[model samples]
Every structure is written in C-alpha cells, then in structure tokens.
Target: MSTTTYPRRHLGQGDLAVSAIGLGCMGMSDFYGAAEDERSLAVLNHALDIGINFFDTADMYGVGSNERLLAPVLKARRDEVVIATKFGNVRAEDGTFVRVDGRPEYVRSACDASLLRLGLDHVDLYYQHRVDRTVPIEETVGAMAELVKAGKVRYLGLSEASPATIRRAAAVHPIAALQTEYSLWTRDVEAEILPTCRELGIGLVPYSPLGRGFLAGAMRSADVLDANDWRRQNPRFQGDNMVRNLALADAVKALATQHGATPAQLALAWLLNRGPDIVPIPGTRQIARLDENAAAATLGLDAAVLQQLDQLLAEHPVAGDRYPAAGMAMVNG
Candidate 1:
C-alpha cells in the first residue's frame, strides 16, 4: 500500500508500459555478496507493494539462481509484474564465465531454460545480455524474433550493443528497448548509442543508474566491500580511482542536501528527467534503499539544478574505466 503512486512509461512505441523506475534484481542473487533468500523475497513483494512492477534479471546472474529466486513471486503476481530477463551471456556450473552465445540454437534453449527457472510461460521483455561478436546481429535477432512469434517473449531488447549493431538488429525486428549502463557517471551511451535508439523508436533502459551504488555516497573506501563482492575487481572501485570517485560522490551528496533529497534520489531524478522514454533500473537488496530509489520517480529537478549537476560532473570527470579489460571488451559490441 503506497500513498504515492508511480506513472508508467512505454518502452518504445509499443504498448509495453512499465513503471518509470525498474528494480534490477542482479545483486540479490550474486555479484554484490552473500544474501538471504527470505530477505530478497521480502524486497520483491515490497517492490510490487510500492507500485514497482518492472523487475529486471538475467540468466547469468547468480548463474541462474537469480531467475529461480523470482519464480515464486512471479507465480503469485503473474499479471501485476512486467518481468524482463536476459540471455546470451553464458556461465559454467561453478560460476565461471564462458563466452557470449547468440547462436540461434543457444538462444532458443536459453529462453526455455530461463522460462523454466522463472516458472513463467512468457517473459515481458527479453534481452541479449551482450553482443556476441562472433555471430552476426541478424542471425541472433532472427532467433529472438522466433521467440516473439511463439509468444515466449512479448518484446525484444539488446544490451551493450554498438550503434551499427543496433541498426542491424532493429532492421530484423523492432527493438523495444536498449539496456545499457547509464548514469551521471556513465554517459558513454549519450554520444551515439542513445541517439541511435531514439532514432529507431526504441526506449532506453539504463542499468546501474546509480553508478552501481557509487553515486549513492556510500562505499567511502573499497575496503568496505566484502571479499567476494564483484565491485572489488571493478577498475572504478579500486585504488586511486575509488579515492577520486568518492569526491564526486560527496559533491552529489551536497547537491542532494540542497535539494532535500538523498544522493540516490538525486541521481535517479536526474535520469528520470533525461526523457520520458528513458527508464533506469537501479539494483538494491535492502527494502529501505528500494523505497529511497523508487521515490526518485516523484522527485523533480528543474533546469537549473540539472545544469548544475551537468557542470559538476564536467569539472570533475570520473576516473578509471568502467570495467576491467576483459569485461570492457564485451560491451559496445
């Protein structure tokens, strides 16, 4: 029971309208650190209670455990939630990274496996987690189109794809959304990828809209992260990079204070103001943090504040690459 209601935005020109802010469910199962199933289940229900219906997950998250985690919730709230999950990024049983697989056969099998794990007949939106460089975009999207024909997926999306690849894929089928890492700190998509998406009538779904919690003004030091947390290995969260980024986070905090909002709210508000077609899914395992983030949907920012944030980030540009070399190679393919 939420006193504040959230507005829905259509992902592209399609009839698929979801909450303005989505919940990214990756960290709850893996990547961040250890998490309790009971706690994660509570957060999922709480999200729906607070008017959040867009749930983003992927087959690779927790090496499939993440999809299993959502099965019970999806079963109970089948009609209320618009579940979006991804495929293409393959992983081994021990959680070792294999390779990006966009082969037609793999695409079909992956969708079946994800549906089985999710306990759902069809997913609202399905994405190719990463572009498989070895395979042509046409071949990969062709298989995805088949899924849509069979009612396995309502809409199709592409993540971390290059502008050219996006064009090629959209030519084959209408791309409902483009999920990329976008935030005040990560604006690489703005240069070309975003324009390409807009040109083709595809909405933008920004994952890690809070810079993977960096822009939240938390994590004063890299040491604060657990030993097994994946952020520890991220280039931006290590050594001198972490020190420099903390200053940027503090600046965001000060601006948020001036606007009577939390740093996470300010960050998400900024993205919400970016456009009506852009929806950002910020991940959190804590109910309090989820509420704090969902509130950003109602936190409005005027032109002056938006310009000020733009200037602050411009003056103090973020340090370090977004990912390590191996991981970086997979994006923008």
Candidate 2:
C-alpha cells in the first residue's frame, strides 16, 4: 500500500544493490512470536509490491524452514530479488542452537541445503552467521571463497564478526557486508567494527536496527511479549531493564511525533542517515508496518535532529545488555 517507490543502496564494493531497507525474513518463520504462514506470505508479497527485493533469512531460522517458506516467491522471482542467508550456528535435533561451525565441509553442505530449500541455483549473498573460533577464520573464509568460484554464491558476508576476524575473512574473499546488531540502543559496533567495515569497504547491514522492535514503539514492557516469545529471555526486555528501556522508546516516540513520522520510521531514518554504506533490515509481519518502514527511506533527518536524538540516548543510556549471557558469548567472534 505504499504510494512511493523505494530507492536502492549498494551493499558492498560489488555491483550488488538492494532496496534502502531490506526485509529480514527470520520473523516470518521463527523468533519474535507465533506466526501464521499465510500472514507471512502476504507480508512478503507486500514487500515486493512496495519495492523490497533484498530478503534475509538463515539456515537455522526454523531449522531450515525459513528458506523453505521463502521458496515459492523466490522461485517465481529469482531474477528480481536478491537472496541473502547465513550458515553456522549449528542446531541440534531438538532445535537448540548448540555452537558455530565453519568447517569447509559444513559450509558446502549448508549452502547446498539452503539452495535446495530456497529453490535457487545461487544465492546473491551468503554469510557466516557467526564466527567459529575453533576453526581459523582463514580456513573458514577460504572454503566460502570456493562457493563463489563454483557459482553457488555471488557475495560473502559475516555477522557479529570481530574487526580482526573481518580482516582475516576479507583476506580470503571480499566480505560484502557485516550484519550485526546495530541500532540507536546498540551502538557498540560504532566504536570498532563499523569503522573497520568502512575502511575495508564492506557495507554495514544492521539487523535489529529497531532494537528488536523496542525502538519501533512495539514493546513497552516484558509483559507485552507473548509467553513463548524469545524477547522474554533477552536481558533488555526483562524486569527493571525493560522499564528503563521504555524511556528510550518514549524519547524516540517524542522525536517521531515532532517529525510527523512513526517511531519505526524515525528509528530507521536515523540509520539511513548514518551513511550511504549502511542498510537496515527491519522485519515485520503486517502490511501497514512494512509500508511505514519503507517510507523511512525518504524520511530525512538533519544534523540538529540527529544531534538531539544522540543527546537523548547519551543521557538515558539503554538499560540492559543486548543479549543474555549465553547469547552474548557468541557475538563478535
């Protein structure tokens, strides 16, 4: 239902380009809360209708079910869309994420399986969802580079990789992007990882750019999440931390009102203003919400507005760690 067409942004140093805001498809099949297949498909179609072609999913999302879910639309429009998915984060039979695996054999098999599920011959972008410290990054990325040579993947990326790991990976292959948890609330990457990506000419793809929907004005407290919601286990959404973070959301909402935009738009607009090399993948199931997010591509924030927003976050300082202790151990590997 968007009346305006979207603008495109280049993801890496390559010719690879996508809508300014890509669609993060993980929520359609896993995480967040309960989801209906019909609703998810509707949202996917709506995204395309509104000019979103960069779709992100992971092999572990729903234990390979996410890629299966996107197969139909992708098969129909393979040439029109850019498919980006990740491997690593080994899952057990019972669906628990056990560890990261970057072995060459696993990388090959994972890419093959993901391609089969997506009904595609080659993915536009393939990423190592997490770095496996046990395996040398050189060994891992050397294998990933083979996929590109074999015509299985066009570009490579890494998520939550440390700056040193990024350099090591890029030594083997060009890392088109570094998808990490980055937003108004989670700015730790700015201190190091972001600048490294800039120097390396790798694009910054910020996942959870709306702070897992908190900055989108969707969550006010832990009580608002479904009982089975993953956010319930996340530190930022629990108890006292939730209350403190609500104030951050309130400040964003206030700025949103002043700009005549929704909180989601304001949050995403701020990211868009960060640099041309940055693109945020904000996921949602509702068509209206997708339209609102897409509109953010055109919502310009001036230096004064950006400064005010930054000041508010500096004064308030987000309350909890971005992830739980166990989850925290895996990032920036």
Candidate 3:
C-alpha cells in the first residue's frame, strides 16, 4: 500500500478506488521518444511512494514492451497498485498500428498475452483501447465479460468510445471507466460524452489532461520536440495551429501565476473540479514532473478561479484538432 496520504476516488461505482491522479505509463516505453528502463522504473517506484496507485498502459504501446516494462514493478508490488492495461489497438512487429481488433477470440488471446507479458494472473481494469467499428460492440464486450467471469479481469472499460457504444457495452457488462482525451484545450467531452458517462454511472478517465504537455506552458514550438517525438505529427503542435494554441497556453499560464500554481497543476485542478468521477492520467518519464503533477490533487481552485478559467478557455479556443486525421477517426467510436 502507498505510505503517502492522497485523495482517492472510485471508477464508477466499482470498489476500485485509486488516487485522483494516475500515472499514464505510455511515454515510459513508447510514443514520446527513447527512454531508459532504469529511469522508468525509478519513476514508477516514486509514483507509488507518492500515493499514485493507478498506472495506465496499453498492450500495443512499444509493441507490448510497455506492459513488459511494468512486469518487474508489478511482480514486486502486486498488491499495492491498481494496474490498468488496454487492448484492441493492434500493431505489427515493426511497431506500426495494424488495426483495431475486438473479435471474441482476439479479446481472449489479447488478455492472455498481456498477462503473459506482465507475468500476472489477472488485470484489475481491462479496457478495449479503441472501439472496433468492424465488430459489434455487443460481441466485443461480451467477450470482455467472459474474461471477467473467468477471473482474468476484475473490471471492464472502453477508451475513445462513443456514448452510444458506451451504452451498448454497459448493457453487456458493468463498465467501470471510460478513458478519453480530455483537458483544458480539449473540452469536446463536456458537451455530451461526459454527461453520458455520468448518467450511466461510469467514471471518466481523462487521458492527456495536460493537453500533451501543451497546457504545461513549456513547448513554444514543434521545433522543440525530438525528431521521433510523436507530438510533432500532431496537428495542434504544427504551423499556425501551434501559434494560436500558444496564446491559450499563455492565458493558462497567466491564470496559473495568479493562483500560484504551475500551469500543469492549474490545468489538472480544473479537470478535478469538474467532478469527483474524473481521474486524469498524465504521463511523464521524469520524477520531477511526476511530483509536480501529483501535487495538483491538493491544489484547490475557488469558484472565481474556476469561473475565470471557464471564461478564459471560452474566449481563447484551442486552435487545432487534438489528433491527426487518421487518429481522429479512431476516437468516439
């Protein structure tokens, strides 16, 4: 168990209570760039010490290397964390995303493969990483439900799933959480997706709650990112869009300065204030950044501050799409 004290929240009505801020482990192994395993391990340990028990990873990340990376930590502290891994986003051997697979056999095989990689018997929360439009949600979730019955998975979830798909999945099984990209810059969820989750008693897990580090008020240009850094390919981080988006980041920085909090902290605190059902999984490979993000749980935003942020975002709308054209097609399925 974590020694440090922190506020905990449940995912939906399930008994899986995790720290309000979960560590998204995708960057430790893939996407962002090259990272040392030793550094990643240290960061993971520090997260546990700081009372962050929820760790998120996907099987396709690093082409299964991400789950493998967490194996050692899970082996040592199996009972101390609420580990969540996702599937459905298939990848080829060359780390190229092949397609989204939600077939019944693929679901079973994927869970088994993830367990084999993690060297674990069961997963606490298993999510369909991306909804497979090729397959019916009922058949996909039914296969996930079978995993629950077999004691292979404790809770089921869906990532980037539409509200209609969410309803369909919940009818098949008790969906614990819905992981989606939500942050200060990406308020698309607020209008419909968020309300739908709340109505159905499914907790909201906001991925990229810091807007892929844009809301952190650091990256002034896409030129700053490493050559292989995936953010470079992101529309929001390119050309004129980046210029316009920085203005929003500047506004966030101004408000954060007034509140005496880092922009990342203020951004996260804003999401936390949205409701108790929200748990933002912000990814970081550095322990310092991890500590900075974890402190957001304690950063309180008054009604006036919240109102200011609301108006600020409303006035300075984000510039570009959250993802590229192909990536955008996968979400809200």
- lDDT of candidate 3 at residue 150, scale 0 to 100: 97
Candidate 1 regions off by >4 Å?
Answer: 1-4
Q: Clashes in candidate 3: how many? A: 0
lDDT of 2 by residue, 1-333 (tens): 335467999978999999999999998877777899899998887788778888999999989999999999887767668899999988975679888999999999999999999999999999999989899999989999999999999999999999999998998899999999989999999999999999999999999989988898877667777787798898888888888888989999998999899999999999999899999999988898898899999898999999999998997899888988988999999
Q: Which ten residues in a row have the lowest lDDT in candidate 1?
A: 1-10
Candidate 3, residues 130-205, lDDT tens digits: the string is 9999999999999999999999999999999999999999999999999999999998898899999999999999
Model 2 clash pairs? none
Listed in order, each prediction's TM-score against the native is 0.98, 0.98, 0.99
Tell me the whole-model lDDT of each prediction, alpha carbons only.
Answer: 0.94, 0.90, 0.94
Question: Tens digits of per-residue lDDT for model 1 on 1-333?
Answer: 344477889997789999999999999999898999999999999999988999999999999999999999999988889999999989999999999999999999999999999999999999999999999999999999999999999999999999999999999999999999999899999899999998999999999999999999977887888899989999999888988888889999999999999999999999989899999999998999999999999998999999999989987799999989999999999
Which candidate order results from sorting by TM-score in descending order?
Answer: 3, 1, 2
- Model 1 reaches what TM-score against the true structure? 0.98
Query: What lDDT does model 3 reach?
Result: 0.94
Question: How high is the lDDT of residue 114 in model 2?
Answer: 94
